[model samples]
Target: MKRLVAILVIILILIVLGLLSIWRLSQDMDVYVSRIDTIQQSVEQKSPDLSLIAQTRQDWENEMQLLTLFLYHSALDEMAEKWLEVELFCREGNYSAAHNTLSLLRQDWEQLYFQELPIPQNIL
Candidate 1:
């Protein structure tokens, strides 16, 4: 029937839209993760640059606005806390602690990034 076909078409469109959304979000997260990796590497240097701490914070602030659209607030809150810890460590000249926090931040970002993807396991 025409009604059945119309319903199927709508459902297909919705599915496509969902997949596209996931793909776009995943790409954005990949870029953010790479930036975090760069920050981590910088923090691990012999003489870590504290300047990178401020720059990383600013980068997260800019990304958070767009990220909030597809991510949970609780996840964002946790990331913000971890980011603050990184800043604190950097300000105190604790490169080791800052490096550790950066590792945690990378893990958190990965978790959040995958959470946005439409994996079959997630759907089931």
Candidate 2:
């Protein structure tokens, strides 16, 4: 029937849109992880690069806006606080603290990335 065909079409469109959003989120998360790794390396070398952290923080703020569409606000808020600590520690020339904070931030992002995937565990 035409009604059944229309319903199927709508379902197909929804599935496509869902897959596209998941793909976009995965890409963004990958970029974020890469940036965090860069910061981690800089901090691990006992060279807290304030300039790099500042630039990354600004970019993350913009990215966070987009992330809100997919992730929970609470997850984003926790990461925001960790990011602030990393920036502050870097500015104060505290490489150890900055490294720790960066690690925590990376873990949070990883968790979010894992949670967003369309895997069997996540669906169930």
Candidate with the greatest lDDT versus the true structure: 2
**What lDDT is reached at residue 82 by model 1?**
86
Model 1 spans with C-alpha error above 4 angstroms: 1-24, 69-71, 116-124
Q: Can you tell me which runs of candidate 2 are displaced by over 4 Å?
A: 1-22, 116-124
lDDT of 1 by residue, 52-73 (tens): 6677677677666655554445
lDDT of 1 at 109: 79
Question: In model 1, what is the error at residue 4, expressed in angstroms?
Answer: 21
Q: Estimate each model's TM-score.
A: 0.63, 0.70
TM-score of predicted structure 2:
0.70
Evaluated against the true structure, the overall lDDT of model 1 is 0.71
